[model samples]
Target chain A: MSKTPLPDDKAMLDDIAAIVEKTGCERKNLIPVLQNIQDRFLYLSEDAIKILSGHFGLSSCEIYGVATFYNQFRFNPPGKHQVKICLGTACHVKGGDIILENFERKLKIKTGHTTEDREFSIDKVACIGCCALAPAVVIDEKTHAHMTPTKIEGIFLGYEIEKEMKIREEKKRDDKDTPA
Target chain B: MMIIISVDDKEIQAEEGTSLLKVCLDNGIYIPNLCYMEGMETPPSSCRLCFVDIDGEKNPVPSCSVKVREGMKVFTNTPRVRGLQWSAFELIMSNHRIDCGSCLSRKACPLIKISRHLKIRLKPFRVGHINSGNEDIVEDHPCLIYDITKCVRCGKCLHICEKIHGRLYLTFAGRGVDMGISFFGDSDDETIPCARCLACVKICPVSALLSYERYEHSPEGSSS
Candidate 1:
């Protein structure tokens, strides 16, 4: 629930402990336990690994190893908006690299890093299997097919409007709650 | 009872359920192998160098995983087997640093031995070398100087650690091209003392894992 993954988070620790209890502690459950943690926190936190190591009676390094072995595992908390640009053969030929550079330049963050505001994160995937949509960019799991550098500005505008609406709705609800 | 198996048209007698790779090796047959050790119930099968063609199988299978059966006909050097092995070896070589002259295990290097046996060049000709991320080899571990560039992703070091310590202290982290390994000197409570056993250094085929003390004194260490 917390964006910053502190190992001392009591609520997160309890949830992780509950996950271990529900999943059972056989070595076979290692992946499932990790998956559950990742599902809950959107990433594999260091504290989660330590909890697993303590519960499973295994070393933390070994737990970390299994977690890192799979591509599905994420060690960093994802930003609010995750951008995955495809760099497969078709996409690469269609200026996927240029699109990635545009995103990095706009966000002021390098690839594989979250923006300082934690609003956006950039990642380059081998392929999204949408070769027909060459230079595909997926933001927040919504695939934007045939993306261009100029197109990124329009997409950001859309997200900004969405964020603005959500904030306004939250403010209105807060105002109503205060009985004014 | 000894079971009879025909390998390369030569009949060999071996115990039932013996690993085909071990059976072949025991009877003076050589198979280019790595990541295999005696008494291992399940070999890592990661190196994938020990491939053999058995009759009735459409594709070449790793010999280390195959158990010798009665009346089984096996071919060790068929074009298919060699082709698969060559590609696998080449892939491994692509990841390898191949600077054998500067390597500590030059004398006992298994890569050189495999290359000679396979009649393939140590340098990969098919698949170009992959840059293994970091060019700088910096290790903070007290006991070992782990050169990431030379590691072949073999689980020998991890296996040996598990066998020796009754738990996996060393582990291969990450997967695919970015995978790396780690070693813990002790457990959380510091109950188990590793004491620089150096088993990993000895077990490594290409000397990816080296003793820090030895590495410090070596010409390679002084220069680095």
Candidate 2:
């Protein structure tokens, strides 16, 4: 059966419309659905907001305000390796600042910024709830505690060497495959 | 009926509609999660600590609520997921007080530990008022203290009070900057007739909620 071809933008709008429609136009569920979209789309694009507002019968600014209000939600595409330094009460008192500085100097990136390589992105967190050790940082999902500037450097070097070694191995294989 | 999914390169079998959070835990892939208290009827996605990346999805979604599908690929420790989780973690931290050395929930808290693991940074965003030490302290209940300064407003206390304790004794009263746990007048006793269930105590992601005897019980470990 021949199917009617809808434009890419319209199809995406339709999908978003369907999601909003499924929520029954309730304001309460707006955030959750937006979250789902953000989850699927990285950042909440203006197009998605327009589609959502149109579907929910709300203003685009209202959607933007709600989107910006929650920290879990974001409006921009983030960098590659997101580094989080714990600045929670316990962590803050326990030299969380030093750890954050270590990241800034080593990665050559400031908080809320992605590295030039786009390989690392850094951020500060309130608390991940492991106050036992205080002054902690999380790289991806691995929690490192009682961090020191020296240890942070060693940790980065370890990842760097591992990454470099992998690249080298790939290069060696490529050379072997070349026609002599 | 079952779908094959990969986590950090290892494949696991999961039911059609199983959540990615459950899948990781079931397969012994411990993805750090603070808000995922087991057996809660409601899925509280309040804490974004459990964010993870899926292959087709653009951004990382909370593993606690997102379902796993057939042939799905996921990465829990990706730079993207870690960055967003850290951002969310910072949002929670900016409102919290910085007195972990003296705080009651020093060792047992998971949020602090996870933040350490992720190397979470706190650049401080303006959120709620920091305790100035001049405002009248509100310790209505003898068993617990509601220090607004220490709270991240994770809603753990509010949810526990309503869900486990029945009546909503502790509502997050006021608007954004002024939000805090407030209770209607119970009696002259200055304490709600809470069952002392300790659900709030357990669910508190930070040291905001504290029990009176918690420190006394652990004399040696009560450094904070």
List of chain B TM-scores, one per candidate: 0.93, 0.76
Off by over 4 Å in 1: A1-10, A95-120, A126-180, B3-6, B9-13, B55-59, B70-73, B132-142, B183-192
- Write model 2 residue lDDT over B89-121, tens digit each, in one string: 776776666666666667776656766777754
Q: Which candidate tops TM-score? A: 1
What CA root-mean-square deviation does each model show from the true structure? Answer: 5.3, 23.5
Residue by residue across A1-180, what tens digits does model 2's lDDT show?
223534854666567777767786777879889888877656665567767766776655456655655767655456655788999999989889888988999888667667776687887788899998778888888899889988998888888998999999999999999956
Candidate 2 residue-wise lDDT at A129: 90
Alpha-carbon runs more than 4 Å astray in model 2: A1-180, B121-137, B187-192, B215-224
The Cα RMSD across the true interface for model 1 is 2.6
Candidate 1 on A37-153: residue-level lDDT in tens?
A: 888777876677878888888988888887767767776667899999999999999999899989989998777778777798888899889999998998887999999888999
lDDT of each: 0.82, 0.71
TM-score of chain B taken alone, candidate 1:
0.93
